[model samples]
Target: MNVAVEGRIEKRHISLSAKAKAYVALTKPRVIELLLVTTAPVMILAQNGIPDLWLVVATLVGGALSAGSAGAFNCYIDRDIDRVMKRTQGRPLVTGELTDREALVFAWVIGVASIVWLAIFANFLAAALSLVAILLYVFLYTVWLKRRTSQNIVWGGIAGCMPVLIGWAAVTHSLSWTPFILFGVVFLWTPPHYWPLSMKYRDEYKAANVPMLAVVRGRAVVGLQTILYAWATVACSLLLIPVAPMGIVYSVVALASGAWFIYETHRLYNRAIHGHEVKPMRVFHASISYLTLVFLAVAIDPLLPF
Candidate 1:
């Protein structure tokens, strides 16, 4: 009987671990990291230095829950297509690690928690923006656009830009040109940042019948669009210098990083047009680094002495 009891205890421990992993998987932690990266830097720039530490923590925790709720809902809504897509085949829903009903319930629980958390700690505006982010990502992007339009990620990217506004609002409890410019910077950057990743997994998207740009258009057109958006993203970054009166460090990093980003995007276009090997993921990863550098400079320039 003792041996049987120990065996039951071990099984229980294993079951709990599996459930823990499943819950974490629903959050899509990597995407949460990207969202939060953009958040804290904006808070820094908004405060013109480091903001209150607890305020930053509260905003970040609230934002994480909101973003995670969006991700969980996305997983639930897309589970059918996810089963077909090779890239998403390992997701918790697709793998049977979590039930659809459980995911849906978890989504609402965390989503509501995010709003309450933000309202109590941040402000109504930030909380409201968090609600908007969840709603936009879920209703506008996932339910409405993902399968219907090739330009889905373009317009859907608006949800991602909400973080900049949320971050800024967390500090000043107001709107300003700076956050709008940063919003534009992120809005324009998303397609270039995401399209290449989609390009890498184009077959999966095609198999899933989702209307990614790569599915509906050839590489030449996709590459051209990436370059155009790269130009716009860089242009928007420059606007912050004048709008915020950012100093030399930010200006230099913005120009340099933006130039590299544009060059890599142009290289993607050149390769696609010339029938050479196009390194799509290289451009994708570079775009992430570019944004990190630009935002880091945003946070730093505010604190630096000219």
Candidate 2:
């Protein structure tokens, strides 16, 4: 009897542990991390220095919850295409680690809780923006656009851009040209950032019948588009120096990193134009590095006396 009781206890513990992991997976923690990366630095910039540490913590948590909620909805909605796509095959829903009902309930619970958390700890504007982000990502991007258009990610990218406004609003309870300019920087950055990854997985999208630019358009065309967007992103990054009066650190890092980002983009374009093997992942990785460095500089700039 004692041995059976111990065995049952161990099994239950293991089951609970697995359930926890599946729920965490449903949150799409990696995407949440990237979204949060844009959050805190903007909070720093919004405060014009380091803000209240606890407020930063609260805002980050709420933002993570909100992004996770939206990601969960994406997973639930895309479970069909996800099953077909090799890259997304390991998602919790695709793997049967969670059910559609389970994912849906989780998304709603977290989504509502995130708004309440932000409203209580942050403010109404931050809470409201978070809710808007969730709605746009789920309704506009996932349901309406994901399968319907080659331009899905272009407009869907707007959902991701709201964090700057949310962060800025959290601090001041208001909006301004600065947040919008940073919003533009994020907006222009998304295509170049995402297109490379799409190019690398064009086959998967084709198999799923998702008409991504990389799947519908040739690599040469996608590469050219990337270059144009990359240049636009750089130009927008530079505009911060005048519009928001970003300091020397931000200007220097933005120019240098923007140049590097555009260079890698052109490299991909050149390879496509020359009939050489196109290295899409190089640009993909470079985009991540560029955004991280640029945002880190944003955080660092206001702390400086100059």
Candidate 3:
């Protein structure tokens, strides 16, 4: 009897631990990390230095909750198609680790919590922007656009750009032209960043009946579109040099990273036009590294003595 009780207790503990991990996975922590990366740097730039420690923490926590809420809602909405796509097949909803109802409730709870947190700790503007971000991701991107249009990610990506504005609002409690330029950088960057993933998984998106650009258009068209967007993204990043009047650090990093990004996109285009087997994941990986480097410069440039 004692041994059976102990065994049951251990099993229950393990089950609870697994459930917790599933809940975390449902939040899509990696996506939240990317959002937070944009947030902190913008906050630094807004203040023209590091803001208060607590305000930074509060805003980041709020941003993470909001991004997590969006991710959870996305998982619930896409659960059916997620099951069909190999890349998303392991998500909590598809894996049966989380029920759609549970995920939906979690999304609401965290979504509301994020707004309240930002309002109390950061500012009203920050809170409002976060609310807009949640709604945009849930409705505009996921519900209205994702399946209906091949240009889905092009507009859906606006939700991802909100972190920059939210971070600026947190520090300055306002809006400005500089953050809008940053916003453009991200908006244009999204296509090249995400389309490659879609390209690599073209068949999966097709099987799921999602209208990703890669599925709707031929490979060469998608590649050409990616290059166009990559160039526009680089152009927008350079605009910050004069707009924010950024110094050498940001200017150099932006130029170098943007060149590398454009180079990778050209490589994709070259392969597509030549009718060779295109390795899109290389461009996809390069896009992430490029964005990271550019933003790293954004965060560091303001702190320099020169």
Candidate 3: list runs displaced more than 4 Å: 1-14
How many pairs of residues collide in each model? 0, 0, 0
Candidates' lDDT values, in order?
A: 0.93, 0.91, 0.92
Off by over 4 Å in 1: 1-14
What CA RMSD would you report for each candidate?
A: 4.3, 4.6, 4.3
Task: Give candidate 2 regions above 4 Å deviation.
Answer: 1-14
RMSD of 2: 4.6
Q: List the residue pairs that clash in candidate 3.
A: none
- Error in Å for residue 211 of model 2: 0.6
* Tens-digit lDDT string for candidate 2 (119-234): 99999999999999999999999999989998888999999998888888889899999889889988899999999999999999999999899999999999999999999998
User: Which model is ahead, 1 or 2, in terms of lDDT?
Assistant: 1
Q: After superposition, how far is residue 286 of candidate 2 from its true place, in Å?
A: 0.4
lDDT of 2 at 6: 40
If the candidates were sorted by their lDDT against the true structure, best first, what order would they fall in?
Answer: 1, 3, 2
